[model samples]
Target: MSPEAGTGSPIGGTLPRPRSPATRDLGMRASLLFPDREVAERYYLPLIYTACRTCYSELEPQEIFDRATSGRVTTDKQQDLIRRVIESGHGSTIEHIVFTFAISGVTRTLSHQLVRHRAGVAFDQQSQRYLDYKRPSYMVPGTIADAPVEVRERYLAEMDESLAFYGEMLEAGIPGEDARFVMPNATRTNLIMTANLRSLIHMSGLRLCTMAQWEIRRLFQLIRHEIFTVSPFLGSFLAPKCVPLGYCDEDRNRDEHCPIRPHKDNVLAAWAEKRAAAKAKGREVPTL
Candidate 1:
């Protein structure tokens, strides 16, 4: 059975789509390559702390770094300063330290979205052009894989045939670059990504949102977990933007379908009502 014949849903519905359970392992992996918890705990906080302290202290930057790195400043004191600076929106302080991750087995679809984050992040992706794929593998969406037996088999067969044709093209003296055109978005790929803490948090905010694509959202979920394993304090900041903003700003989410955060429109409407009431009583409400 063709997938088109199976579902009557519109292509771009405003309502959130029902996501299949993420129980199936898509073989996605995101491993932190730098700064294990101890390193992060020892230097990351101090680095940011030094950056923050250098602003207020008359001392040189190196002196601040030395004091923060050495036992001159206590951990509690360093963390307190770092936390205050971060909360006050001094993002550059956090940018002094970076985290690297070795990500593998993600589909090209996810990689394309991941690379859209251009600020403070660097990516080194596995080159499809340089290496001939002797055994190409691809990801299957959970929804497609959990379809009716016939539908599932059809999907699998199509992927198999595409790869087989790719192999046939290679045998016929076709260049790998040209043969790779047949590869679908599901084609698995690997990448090495490096991003500062600030950028990581920013990326997490968007990708962790309920409105994000299911696969990419899952990827961020894995990333957040990895960060949490190393530093829960830093990991605590890796949440949906709405989680921090206290309101959902997404246009499609105006219907309040996703309950993670209240719709911004509703919040504004409620505030307007309160202001109207206050105005009627001849009292001006002070705007924040």
Candidate 2:
């Protein structure tokens, strides 16, 4: 693993970091399709602030929104309130706003995992049943790409043969849907995904984790970059689950292979030690 693979930590601890792969071209792209900088800057925050403020304010939502968007409520104050609300786990407040993306050339492997996020997100993928693929493209994992000549060649040959046979089946009058059965998980696909801010945060939490599959992690990185271009404040929330939780929770992280954060088990053990010391001093320690 590269020594500089993970982001700098605000928390006080060191752990193993995995070597994150570079996405670089890789025949895939994810572009933010809605809320350009102007819209994001002018409305997205205010929209979310309104949602948060509505819970406590006696004023009508429109009045709150007008106050927020028209600058009567300073952006700093709105952001402070919104940030606090979000950190407090008021998820429904953030769900009032959404982001849409134009995703293309990702593998069926990735699309399968992505569409699994059902709540507060919608996905429309290219249909093999409807669109007849002419020259299908596919992904080669770095392992395969860097394999020995004979191994790499065999992998490519098998993929090429599978795609070619699918084409032949199409020519022989097999339905595209049936022929698509021959397509490998590596076959590239496209999708349009729209997700509410809460869902996006939740999805990013999982997909940005080192434990996540590399392709999906890279996809979220691209998605995060796109969000940063428009709104860095909101973009900051799209991070590994451990980032928000303050400790890694994945059972696999017990060995500390991907040291983005201290594992939850370790954190709890330390907390218990502190509690025991406090008890020894005849003091009460708060429970987590």
Evaluated with TM-score, which candidate comes out highest? 2
Error of 2 at 22 (Å): 2.6
> Which parts of model 2 have CA positions greater than 4 angstroms off?
1-18, 285-288
**Backbone clashes (count) for model 1:** 0
| Worst ten in a row by lDDT for model 2 | 1-10
Looking at candidate 1, the ten consecutive residues that score lowest on lDDT are: 1-10
Stretches of candidate 1 off by over 4 Å are 1-22, 286-288
**Candidate 2 residue-wise lDDT, 154-253, digit = tens:** 8778888999999999999999999999898988889999999999999999999988998899899999999999999999999999998999999888
TM-score of candidate 2 relative to the true fold: 0.91
Question: Total clashing residue pairs per candidate?
Answer: 0, 0
TM-score of each: 0.89, 0.91
